[model samples]
Target: MPGASPAALPPAERAAYGRHARTRASRSCHGWFEPAAGRPDPVDVLERQSAARLPELVPIRYGRMLESSFRFYRGAAAIMATDLGSLPHTGLTVQLCGDAHLLNFRLLASPERRLVFDINDFDETHPGPFEWDVKRLAASIVIAGRANGFTPKEQNTAVRACVKAYRRRMRDLAGMRALDVWYALDDADHIRAILSTGTHREEAVRRAGQAAARARTRTHLQAFDKLTRVTAEGRRITPDPPLITPLRDLLTDADAGLRQERQLQSLVEAYARSLSSERRHLLRRYRLVDMARKVVGVGSVGTRCWILLLLGRDEGDPLLLQAKEAQPSVLAPYTDGEQYDNQGRRVVAGQRLMQTAGDIFLGWTRVVGLDGHGRDFYVRQLWDWKGIARPDSMGPDLMALFGRLCGASLARAHARSGDPVAIAAYLGGSDHFDRALAEFAQSYADQNERDFAALTAAGQSGRITAQPM
Candidate 1:
């Protein structure tokens, strides 16, 4: 079994292996939970991450995390990685969404223009235990459920529904042929059906339709109209300080600014090489017109993120691409680092593998920073019919439905990389794992509260600074 591959193992043998694993690592071990002694400090990890990020924007990141306990859990992937690394694992691996919080699952238009539900962030994605992703998803539900003021019973019910959905979906995928599993997709209609039984069914369906309609309209032209103005030279990005600032305004020297422009041009050229020839040809239709530093997401606040506005055929045509910095996955130190030298490529590869359909413009590049150091970044269309559900707006039942969707989607993603047959066998035809996950989710929810409390105290004591948006 030394070189045994999950993919190569036969279904019977894999099932046997999974049962054998269960004997050693009891189903009960899956429920075992506690903060490991000498766990890494959450704030210390944040500070270290900030070192590579723009210093001026670090406060915004902290402020976003400080907004609520659930928000803190979303931004504290590094902290949980340390804790998860110390947990008992089955040695089963998948392309993990290292930060599989409830909010990270969203609806977006696929290449075919159909809206599909999938994991939306890969900044910390890497190969890891499938259970780790499941655990993180469960914990996030618990924390978010608490944030929504769900009763303890309601919270446990949501966590159970999530784990049950995951278990059932994995079992379903385990039985499917390889090609069928690969072809499986959770589209908007499928998600609508899942939420159709809840008390807010009509409202949910109405919202889903509205979201789908809204997503279709959120194209490049919409973004261009909203963010750029018809300038004397051409369409230019309107300056919005702190949130969206053009690079020209930051680099004062004329010679230095010219060099920076050349560097950006070279970066895009390199990124184009990562795409297929057809996509590259399609990209050549546009000319890069303007770029601006744009702050995005709670955990991604300080990281170098830019939005490049490209003008296509005429004044009416436009394309927006986001170039976001890629660093080592938070799981890197806990497990082996990425195989690819380019972290950006690692992110793109993980996304392509886990996602049913991805942005055609997805690519990676290397950029020389203002500090003269190079960083890896992944580029993709910024507003490709994307829509996210606001957790605060949902009731307990809707949140539970969202939890189920997240669980099912995570199972599909893991099925692509791990042995779903074995995972299904490991899960068995029972709710034991579901109950165990509920217990673990609650325990971790308590830990999250403690961690959030510590972080809040740190901010209050001036150990960390926060600037709320």
Candidate 2:
């Protein structure tokens, strides 16, 4: 609504757009995405420009073999941008957990230790098209399915089923009581039904059990492995080679030092208020053990992340909390509400709204960062009952089942935030969005190949520092 004029963009922005047209990447993107209009094709434009602009991201290329599957999983996510950022849409939007791939939907324990399925990532959230979310979910299903040897037709059936289920779920949600809308999620009954279905029954049951068992907060006794040592001095974070580094390895600036103090000062007051008096009482027992600016997420390589270690009673007994900078919801600008100045606060609020049971430590704060830029972040447990079932690991049947679950979960999330009836009407019980998204997914996947090739070429030519394949 801010700039709804279809005929023309405002003059200053038009001038700036014209200026960017002269750049090499911009001109090259225009060759395909926006050939006649002098505008870059949105997908091509996005991919091409993003590939070049985000040089700070440690680019990961195709066919890179790693010793660990988790490392490979994180590396492979870079290519997913093609599907995530390129969807044709009407712009009806809601807060989205930006990385809504099939694998990202999983069972997490509620506070009561009951497993619940929901969206589990929010790193790339920012206002854009809702179709972008759906398309990403569908394509992740197909790609992961193909990797696991599923027929194309089989994948399509899964995709259609997901769309159908989402439509039905949205309709049901729209008719709920206002409070009921907020209360909606996978209840114990729903989990039992899915477990009874016998589709990947053994795996689901194991995951549910794991979720329940690990739902306990990581206390000091179990926090450290053989690597960490406790002495008379304050507890210090021991570094692991290659993967985990100490804060002293990277952080040196005195200014960066004060910035963290400011965050702590703000966080202490705000989060303390959000907690019940009983939880707050628990907080008084711990002293700030250590804090560090940490790196996190696959697509969120350059984003800001921080970890706080809290010591309770003795140095060895600790509570670990992570405060990561939350990017704005992709739907915020289009969805109704005040635009959040701090994206992290938006993320925390949105998560609480959409998730069935949230982390007890979840809270928000703002601070000036090491770069002297003002930032906002929300804090929570480093890992709750989170376990991603990799897309590439899914067999055909498993992939389809995964897709339906993601579709159902996404429907629940959107229904809680957006007007479910209108969204359902917009979907119209048809495959228009689904098929359009499938078409978009294929087109974008092809584009991902092109950009991946370009990035690989650039890396080979010594133009970028990429993880070697």
Candidate 3:
């Protein structure tokens, strides 16, 4: 209750209110899934979103989305939000990972040097219905199950495991002290135990330690070795077109390159203001060496992302930071406007509120682009022992186990900003919510396939462009 806003009603009354909500919007209604009347075309939604992004990179977003139905689902957060908005929800709000796809959860090194599993992406994070996150997470399992060749029964089992884990975890969190729930985190050992077994499990343990060690050791020196080389004039980042291309290569004019360098310098200075005083001082120790435009993630391909390589006391000491563009959350329209004007701050604040351990260098800034338009961006370490459970390679059993792990993690995240007691009461003791969610997952998966096919047809008909096969 330390940071929680005081409620007019007591805890028990709030919980009873949730139970009452079930009568108006029965837990059974969660199972209801059908395309709403006059639903907008998913492709059209995507095309409208593309208009605001970098024109050249839009095709890459479409290209990556074209790979599979699951990938399409990943990139189509806006489309899903439109559908989720039409559904009957409990009206209870929480900080949602608006794009809570399976791949977005990953392992990262905590500030304490321990490896932990958490929701790693927050580009679309915002306060919204708690069920929205759960629904999206459940649908991800169904889509991934299909992509991994799981049978219908196996996929249903995965969905059940996920929803059940969420229910059980919410119930557990509800009984615990509020401070305890805030302090809870999923460590590497616990996550490995839940998701891996035999050689895979043993490998996970080894990898966890290795990942921690690498995070500590993989500073600017390691990055310089991998991404830069000794040049006649100090060290310069090697150019890898499309993926990592230096600004110098993109800007032929010397003055133009200098202007970009100045812009980035100003951006970093503004970003430093968002960090703690200690972190700001720590950041000042490094000097920017090079920067490049980098494309990251299937859904984020079209966004403006840049990597800044910095040098510390000497060439041996280095740091790598990524500046990723942040736009309004897909949930924005449905919910009230955010308190923060800058979307980058919105993303950073939501991330800090939800995750147990957040990036030490996390910060936000706004900058004018080459086109003279302003954009908001958040900055953090590009990588810190980040890894994901590859759903495509996992068997049904392992995938189910991983789904449960993701489910529990998500529950803890929601509890941070939501009423766990209310959520648990709404779920009840039986598997009603689980079965309902499973059915909804199946129905949504079918819709995803249809939407994906629509996009493919648009591409084939030359209405929309896609990457070459």
Who wins the TM-score comparison?
A: 1
C-alpha displacement of 30 in model 1, angstroms? Answer: 2.3
Candidate 2 lDDT tens digits, 1-469: 3444311444345334323323412212311221123323333432443353224434432223122222333333434443233323444556666666775676665667556777777655544444456666766665555556667777677676666567677767766766787887785467555544546767755654554455443233455443355546656666652234455555478777566566565666666666678877887787775655554655454455656777787765677777776655434433445577777777777687667767777777776654566667777776655545656655555555556667877888876656565455556555555665554444544554445455456557766555632
Model 1: lDDT equals 0.87
TM-score winner between candidates 1 and 3: 1
CA-lDDT, candidates in order:
0.87, 0.57, 0.85
Candidate 2 least-lDDT 10 residues: 26-35
Candidate with the larger lDDT of 1 and 2: 1
Write the residue-wise lDDT of candidate 1 on 75-101 in tens digits: 999889988999888766678989999
Model 3 per-residue lDDT tens digits across residues 311-340: 898777878899999988888877854578
Q: By TM-score, how accurate is candidate 1?
A: 0.97
Candidate 2: deviation at residue 168, Å? 2.3
Ten-residue region with minimum lDDT total, candidate 1: 1-10
